[model samples]
Target: MIKEQGEGKSRYMPGLDGLRAISVLAVIAYHMNVSWAPGGLLGVAVFFTLSGYLITDQLVAQWQTAKRIDFAGFWMRRIRRLMPAMFVMLAVVGAWLLLFDPERLASLQGDFVSVSLYFNNWWLIFHQVSYFESFGPPSPLGHLWSIAIEEQFYLIWPILLTVLLRFTKQRGKLMMFILLGAAASTVAMAMIYVPGSDPSRVYYGTDTRAFALLIGAALAVAWPSRSLSAAISDKSRLVFDILGGAGLLAIVWLIWKTNEYDSLLYNGGLALFSVLTAVVTAVLAHPASRVAKAMGCRPLRWIGVRSYSLYLWHFPVIILMNPSGIADDVHAGRALVQIALSLLLAALSWTCIEEPIRRGFRSPFREKIQGWSPFQYRNKRAVSALALMLFLISGYSSLNADRPADPSPAIIDTSSNGQEGTTLPVTDPGIPAVVIPEAPIPMEPQPKSEESSKPATNAGITAIGDSVLLDAAPHLEKLLPGIMIDGKVGRQMYQALDVVDQLKAEGKLGDRIVIELGTNGAFSSKQLRELLSSLQDARKIVLINTRVPRKWQDTVNSTLEEVANEYANTEIMDWYSASKNKQTYFADDGVHLKREGAESYAFLLSKTLQGG
Candidate 1:
């Protein structure tokens, strides 16, 4: 710990700032859809752990010195530090929306309200929105949820810590209490989390995520001293070195190997990541640790100092600069421009807005004119004029354009009167006059081979999947007589295992099986192997791959291909390849099918079933 004097605080750790830099960069890379950082979103857990440690350390120091906590002052400090930059970003985004895309205003308005109130996570949960699921354009303010969690902790924790300090002088008891809370939160997460499904309920819940924060607080309670006597002994140093090395390796492994879709993530992955990060944090907190010195390099410290502003501005900049949606393939040139602009904005915000506000400068309205360097002041004036001109043009275009349309998700609608046909409509805000064709008439009975013509053919074939399978059910039934499709919205493969077992017990496990379960989320290779064993009695098995534009797409597809190659009874449908160029066949969500897509999909399956 470097005891640099800053505003009367004795403890300063530049290496911690380097950690912040790493965390925010990982998150930015993940949001950019960079292939190398699949688990980059875990950066949020790092931030959470850091927050817990820093905030707890401060509270404990205040208690030890002043023997009392200044709750009101602490709250005001946090609000002053965070809210000003947040409001600036929101105002800029709101103006951009009003000028260029008023259609998003309604949703943005709701998001702004929730964020301002520090309840954005609950609002997202209420709307059943999953952070990992990219269905449309990315929301600029989507990252605010983490800030909300931090603020929530800031609001409630000081009071709780004060009470604990007043009640018990024993640090051990307090640590025990915190451990209990962590245990409860972890259990709650494990209970609510469902593998291979939308994880919004657990991911966004404060109760479920509090464990990461608690882990940090526990470490703060046990933080080692920098004094020579308290310096790590040779044996203890070896232990720290091993734990630190293992923790760093684990984090790097997870970043490369895991993604949001992995089931292990829900089971225990996040908590494990937090624990490992805590171990690294302990090593970094000690000044004698060689790893700490390496992480405290000048560049990492500089980025760490500006990390907050970078995080606040990067996502909005990415969204605004991206003409194509976030989930689409990114142009390298555009991505580079986005990164450069985001960094520039962060630097400007740091110098012009954040520092001045923190230093109690005159109103920002006045500083806009006088506080900047002469070069910056002139550039700011020119930029302001240009912005005004563009805003007017955008406003005129928005007004003269047709009223904005609300985008609706595509849904399957089976025809009435017990028909075996499905039609899907793909809706977009633009092209209001776009018409979707009705379902194709059922296919006439095709000539059957000796094997296909067998009686009691209802027992010959069955298909199980999620809504993607539901979209193709009617077409499949029409093309292949007496085919059974058991598809439910949001169905997971684990649930499908039970369905298959029930079918087998009823003596209805068909001679052939088609499983299309990975669209919603990813399953482990072990799960896939178990599912295949359940269907081993079938003469032929079909695994339909997914083309959903989510992090899990490749994992699901690759797993299917690998398992299929190893099993003589199985083959993959290659839907990802078939659907690659057929963009018009998909809805705006880029997963479910339109009518023509369903027809193409059914035809492919029909041919594959016939050994084509």
Candidate 2:
């Protein structure tokens, strides 16, 4: 009698899939910038819980039955289950990049290596990668950072658990202590460090994320046996279901309401929320919970079944369709299109790639115990060779790729001499004395005549933008000879506005404010409006519109034009159009100005300011 394929052991849990659906959907919505999914990133935490619980549950079951765990077999199973589909996805994406987005493709090779090697989190940390930087485009596999985190956890967690079990000699108690300690330590750390820590560090750190997984592990280890399961009455089960559903909703609500500013407290709350979910899931595994049955609804179960594929496909779809810089314009519409496309692609991937491979792994023919075990069947030499080849490909791409020059000033300023109300030349052979201007008279006291012979009191030009603007400063000063140009380089628009206000108060509101910004940054319309509006007193504010790659030019143009129209002092410098007509002005990066371009920009800007 062929043992009924899915008999005795309930390998299918609809609620777990429902939970996965929740996790993946939240992440997708968040990435799409849906107004309601503020905390969608917390979906990774949910996934951690599910992964910990399922893996630990399997391990505990094996341990109980066999009296020892086969670590090699377990890891081999993990590799086969995870790697094949991942490899296929990466290969497809790599090929796509080569055909359509070769420049971005070259940059993505490192990310491909990181994702394939399961080390993307470390790559991000080492590079200090910011999610907001206006690079030409982002990697298709940037979302793999979370996968890297999970894989990294698995590399150490199983060994740690095994060692702890050996020492404690009691699985339940050991997991209990680990769970309690993780939760307490995470909460404590969040309280202490999150207040001042960089938001990215807080978001990505394993220490803070461990508690969610531990909560799931705790449930698996401490699960009540069948005998005790009978003691939980129907009423208690109903209450657990209601409370668990409510808790899930509350967590979603919190995520929707919070932003990066509130992430510290919100993530802490998520830990508590995840723990509640684990408890509910563990208790509701019994056949009696109505809410659990509801979670097992056909649609949710299907979404959960395809969750991994959905997760993998959604981000790339969103990225490919929306592109960088375009997000502000088609953020909502592109998001919907991405979601629909992702679902279609996910369905195809699930039907053709993931399910087939997973099924093949579980096939009885593959499970046959030959003299060689599954671990031995895994060709270590082949795996190593593949890893090396991928690494080489990544290294080749990265070495060949053109990276930006480091912006840190090579020369340090050490001068002590102070000068007041002195105009410094751009071609300063040496660092000049710091000039302190006379006490600021009110703006009302200043004369407005364009030809007034009274010496111009303030700096003639003030350039503000990101690192790229720093390159334009010397030329700007040259064009406005002896005009005391005040350059606030490497600042975001809003931060630069603050500096502008301070300079205005100090009597440095120059006749012309040439903003050579846009490169190295992207801003929302609201943010750009606020920044432009703040420059109310400048006689002329020249917005040096950025010339981005063709893909992003339209977005840059639209945003700049909108902001310029809203402010009376603002006029777009049309750098994009100018650069097209004079290609020598742009650097190879296509964003920063070349030396000639900088000088040309300065010439045109000076003419504009002089009312020529």
Candidate 2 residue lDDT tens string, 285-360: 5456666678778677777777887888777666655433123223455466567656755655555455446566
Candidate no. 2 TM-score: 0.63
Tens digits of per-residue lDDT, candidate 1, 1-612, equal 222112124466766777888888888888888899988889899989888877887777777778888887788777777889888878887887786777766657779998888989888877665687544566778888888888899999889888888997788888888878888888888889866556767888888899899988888777733321336578877776677667767777787677877766667778888888888898777766666667778778767767888999888777665544353456697678667667766666666666667656754533432212232554765654554454345334533343225544565322211123333323343433323334222222343576555553434788877778778877887678777777665566666788788777977577899898777666778778888988887899999999987677788888888888878999999899998889778865678888889999999998898789
Whole-model lDDT per candidate: 0.72, 0.59
Tell me the deviation in Å of residue 29 in model 1.
Answer: 1.1
After superposition, candidate 1 runs with Cα above 4 Å error? 1-8, 224-246, 362-427, 430-459, 470-478, 488-490, 498-509, 526-530, 565-568, 582-589, 594-596
How far in Å is the alpha carbon of 215 misplaced in model 1? Answer: 1.5
How much is 396 displaced in model 2, in angstroms? 25
User: Each model's TM-score?
Assistant: 0.82, 0.63
